[model samples]
Target chain A: MATLTELTPKLAPMEPVPFVVRSIRDELSDTFTLELDPPDGVFEFLPGQFTMLYVFGIGEVPISVSGDPAQPSTLVQTIRGVGAVTYALRQVRPGDVVGVRGPFGTEWPLAEADGHDIVFVAGGIGLAPLRPAIYSVLANRQRYGKVVLLYGARSPSDMLFTQELLEWGGRYDVDVLITVDNADRQWRGAVGVVTKLVRRAPFDPHDTVAMVCGPEVMMRFSAQELEGRGVPQHRIHLSMERNMKCGIGLCGHCQFGGRFVCWQGPVFSYDELAPLLLVKEV
Target chain B: MPETLVLDRSGLASILSELRARDYLLVGPTIQQEAIGYGPIDSLDDLPQGWTNVQSPGASHLERRDDERLFGYVVGPHSWKKYLMPNEVVIWRGERTDTGFETVPPEPAPAYALFGVRPCEVAAIAVQDAVFMPTDRVYRERREAAFIVAVNCTQAGANCFCTSMGTGPAVGEDAVFDIAFTEVDRNGTLAYLVEAGSDDGAAVLQTVVGAEPASDADLAMLESVLQEAAASVTKTMDTDGIHDLMLANLRNGYWEDVGGRCLACTNCTMVCPTCFCNTVEDTMTLDGTTAERTRKWDSCFSIDFSYIHGGPLRMTPEARYRQWLTHKLATWFDQYGTSGCVGCGRCITWCPVGIDLTAEVAALRRVDARQGLSVPLPEVMA
Candidate 1:
């Protein structure tokens, strides 16, 4: 038998600090993005990581950081008014305080994909979560090869980060392909599922790392399409979504098979998640 | 034989007095509404003496024993979790300040003396520790201050399978406990063979009167009694490759069969000492000023357990059952270094429809023999 060792007492698990909302911009009728100022002029987080946004007496919801990693003074998150908590977040005014507990979960693997071409597949509001990764790649553009972003939405109006997409489109280094399921009268871009653009998208599949974020069905098919084009399954990454009640793994709501989506991943390689994704209604 | 103390029935009363004088809240089993339930007790007379619980799948009742042996019952609906983790607790409380909402420091956990904790329950507490410790200070504070007194089972219940789970009959060598006792019931006369696993436990016993050091004969008698208890457990869960067996057969139709009978009532999880799944909810006053973030025990059996923005991932009742079962038997080993189930059989005896997981596993193995099981692709892909 060995002598027992003493461990330091664990701090309180759930601690929410107040962050003042600097601005709120409506991306669509039901969606909005919030810019918050932390007490200290810094709140650092990896790309693809999320925070538990608490709206005072309302509730909390897991929202990913859509801001640039370089900017620590301002914490940014995009959310849809799908539930009570999110709706309360949308109603918050600038200067109003909201609670935040995070910078949790696995981040996008930009370092692993440094020298390889990066292909981003984003659908509707899913683009918000992938925006930070896009910013990171663009900032270190010289380290990476060809960069392509294929974004899809229900309609042209449902698209998020439209202004940012236009700027990325103008860039000579990045190829931004936009698609809508249903075209409006003024729309002129590709009108189909994002997976359709996977065919015409110019990137070397053998030397490319694909980052996908979207509804489950879209991600499954996008990864399938990427795999068909010779991109290794392990190189294709996805940001998973489950009921993440607690950003910590203590709440069992975010379990996707053996993995806790809040902890082990919101980002997992296609190869690692292939078997789990295959299991129906799990 | 290790140094042990022999405490007759009178000594048991003295032990209770000593614990009370130490200001420790004694939580032990007592007769409650025709069933033995864990509650606060002061004296030996408060124990469910001369009473035994007859537990089967979805059934349990109190029956008077011929001998007045304390700790006669196997287990009941109430587990020690009610005291430690609790059913509902306000982990965080906040009030609206002029700046914003600020959290109020929570009150400290109560000091508890868990009296007559079964060996299987001792294992269950250890399982929960692996699940909650190092991260959840809310549950840790309660667990760290609590003292456990484990009692060995002299007889196994009808639903008992702790022997098969390797967590029972006699407490496992690695099981956590402060003190352990094996009751020797000889024709209605009761004597406890007590041994301290901690210095604090020994110090407490040192103060009790009429405590005599045990002899070699008493130690041998204790060993045979434990052996008898193990042999009596007819119900067994064969754990050979259970992890892979469960994870591989996610679409087993046996789940559909169990789903038909299981009411999704959440009784099993409530009784399961190791089922630590919970959900946090926020409650505010009518004025919408002060708010509390409360953590409540939740069951995977519920339809809303896996709900996201769109809907619940597991809409089908059979899918929920599969999630609960697979998570318990297979993924638990992956999450914690040990199996989630201590095999106390509380889940079996307390289940509304008697959905025995041991039998469910047997059914899955039986059905799997046919091969070519249908594991349909995701609804969208299909």
Candidate 2:
């Protein structure tokens, strides 16, 4: 996270410099990924940080960076064209220009969890924010212990990073377990909530750093199951998403209890957020 | 380290002229739509002469005072945030052309001399300073350029609790007020004991006609006036362990009761001095050639404030009201390292339903002993 108050942005706070879309790839029916040529040079950002993407005259929304942290040349963002702003952003052609602000918020503990077993739990489209951390772990695969990824989607077709999931499953060093809420006869993997696979996943709970992201209810259940496995609350981090504007923390839209999810979080340990997550509508 | 200057019967007029001479757009208290609103002030006559306000839960009335004091009334519905953060402003404007786009940069903040600012409002400005400091662009510019002239309160409104909040009826020596004044009644005529907090204010005072250095007795009278003002505030919000109190009772039953009465009309947030939540609006021409991203005041009470992929997180009035109250009383400290409220009574007075937060906090404390997700219970309102 941006803990230092003095490291302000280089550009004018609200002003946006435009960037051209280099490529577009459709991940799912409603979700797509946009890779943009950097406005200045390279759009450097930490794993799990987000940017406020603006569609010229349409609007802006906070989208997490889904690209590799090491690749600073191209900025990659996943959009679930759910709102007017995201829908407008998806309408952009390859050469079209758009606005970008920030690379704000805290990063995943990929560096801190280097010596520990890493378990990544993702639900539905939650993999977008966790992708950067996965890439980081793969780049420095020798530095980590056991690596496991437990992903659950609404259906097989709704899953994200399908190609990468298969590639990781083929590796002997990485454990990739996939599940779905409902499936047809064509499917062979487990068909249940992701929380059920927490017990069967191969990792020492005491020596693992768990990073989870998904729907709130799924995250809550996954966290509970993880805690039940004897993994400490502080060792488990959840990537949170909340409504926010002016990602610098001026606008109060992203306030989750006392924590501004835009700045202080986006990645908060279960120990810091257990009390808040338990309450409904908090 | 500046001494108080005494301005005679014509001193008020000279002060107004001096401010106008500096090319500052003077914004002060005035009568607008049956309320005291901060608007343009051309002369001393523009002030609400003898008007006093009576504010209570869900109700407020204007009454004529017997004395002919210039600033007899306390703060009304208007706050200084309207000028600094603004209700709406085009922060970024862009025009699309054939090859690329042209841009019209945001305009600079205007030079302003804010007259008749109260002590509570001053504290509120400080709270906002910590919030917008990180992105210090428009807010910092407007706040830095605008001169502040704080006036010590002669009386407190019924809903006011500045004393309890420790953001006073008196502007202290440590305050950032450019010039502070205490209105006094000398025999039958009205006079002012002026103290300059900044060098610019002292320089302006030196050029004023008929201005003389105030004596020790005059300074003592100013103390007495502030002491009386401090004793007059009736309301209170017991901030003792407020942070944990609200956090522990997130699902407190009393919140449901407050939700039942809250209209969610958002009058309270609009009138609040330190409520700095806002939303950005994008407007473009029919041809889509030009676009402007304007920031407007927003309330957490609004459903869209929490809208995400599935739907709005805070769906019910109870949830929205809980978020707003908990944010104002508790979570604000964690976010900005300071209390969000300044204890100004605008939220209480301007609320159409009169859902007082002071009463709500007290009620929350009473019901917290048996905390649960229980149905709405009888209110413990005082």
Candidate 3:
């Protein structure tokens, strides 16, 4: 393994190093995935961490890592062009040089749930942040128990990594269920909220560990449904989203209550966050 | 070993000159726009002497005192953060190159000698130290290089509550300082009791002429003055179980009541010494060739502070107020294992509506106690 110093020598936490866009793949109409190659070394990060992507003349925004962690040199980030910075990032072509800082924040608790049944839940473009975790689980398939993935999107065209999802579902050991809010004429999958699929998914609620990522409201309801199925609050983990300006936690835009989501978590268990989440507008 | 000495009022000039000779920019409280604020102090003439501050909720003014005392007034709107962390700092500037872009990190800060630092301010700096010292390169370098000349407060303002917070009125033994001084009125003559906390402080004092070793009587006078100052504090806070109290009453109506009156102008947060929230911005040159990323002080009161893709987490004024208070008194204990507030009372004095945190806490406790007593027991349990 290359040391951090060798990866980006003499770089400050806030400093952004140059990375060239190797390729850009359109995931959805609004979202695209970028594969980047650093000037010096690979950007090594764990599953469920994010990077602060900077466009040359525009600004910087936090985008989650959406690639396999094993290949640390290949920097991959999936972005939805919602804001100004992201919009500029979406227009980038291959060979364009952009500044990249981090691969920061808390990682998914994949290793901690070694023997336990794993349930991965995602909503809309939220699946982008969970792709790395899914890859980690698939690579180390024998280390865990039953693995289930439930994904929900707005429409058929909105589904990300469609080919990979199908391949994962084809595996005899995995269960993949995809849902859409509103289905088109050709759609054949279930059409309802993602949480509804939880009732039919085969897993022992007591023994399973669930990781959820999506909109705030969706995550809240999903957590509720998981709890209703007898899953302990601590066993249900969810990734939180906040305006992250400084990925190092100093900028303070990502504070959720007392915890800086940039540092302490973007992934937190339901038990640790229940009290703060219960309070309105925390 | 800590050594004590006596320096008459006339000796302050020599101290300033010594620090100036050492290439340290001297900063102290000075008369500025009817208030005593921290600014560049070239000599003793700039220090706010014979002028004490009168502070109440939402208001503060400088008035003439009967006797001459350099450090009589408590803290003003300005804090050490303006010097250390700064309001605006360019973290790095990037220039476009043929390959990509070359970035330049910010320059290191100059050495500073902060004169007239009170004990509470020291505690505030320490709280910020725990925060920025670990992660912030700029703050750590500037704070580590600072030469602190702490002044033990002999007078407490109307809003002062450092005693309740156990942070001030006197520089405690455990407090970190280069030099600590307590102004004593002996037979109506102003004399400063000086103590060296570090070896550098002792070396500086060695250069002073006609300085006498403090006798037991002088030490006795200093003790009585500090005790009187501590007893004179008008505001108090019950910090026991304050974290739990705030958490339990997060949804209480008191927040709504206070929020209704709060303009969310962010005065309290801006004036607070420990509120370290900030935001970053990128500014490009006219030609768009070079860009600089600057970090500025930010307040949680603003709706944009917590903004995400959908909307801001805190939309209402009440929620922002709760966030500020809860983080200061409660969640901060959970985050850093110490209260964020150093009890400097700047928030109370600088607040547009004069919102007193101590009063708010007291009110919440009263309401919480009342609610607990009013709850009826279950018939089966009874």
Candidate 1's TM-score on the B chain: 0.95
- Higher-ranked by DockQ: 2 or 3: 2
lDDT of 2 by residue, A171-282 (tens): 9999999999999889998999998989899999999999999988888889999999999999999988889878878789988888889889899999998988867777
* TM-score for all models, in order of appearance: 0.97, 0.95, 0.95
Which residue runs does candidate 1 get wrong by more than 4 Å? A1-12, B186-188, B369-382
Considering only chain B, report the TM-score of model 3.
Answer: 0.95
RMSD of 3: 4.7
Model 2 chain A lowest lDDT segment of ten = A1-10
- The DockQ-based CAPRI class assigned to model 3 is acceptable
TM-score of chain A of each: 0.96, 0.95, 0.94
Question: Which of 1 and 3 is the better model by TM-score?
Answer: 1
lDDT of 3 by residue, A198-281 (tens): 888878899899999999888888888989999899999999998888888677677787788987889999998887776678
Alpha-carbon error at A226 in model 3, in Å? 1.4
Model 3: residues with Cα > 4 Å off, grouped in runs: A1-12, B369-382
User: Among all windows of ten consecutive residues in candidate 3 chain B, which has the lowest summed lDDT?
Assistant: B373-382
Candidate 2 on B201-235: residue-level lDDT in tens?
Answer: 77777778987788888777878888999889889
TM-score of 3: 0.95
lDDT of 3 at A137: 91
Q: How far off is residue B13 in model 3, in Å?
A: 1.5
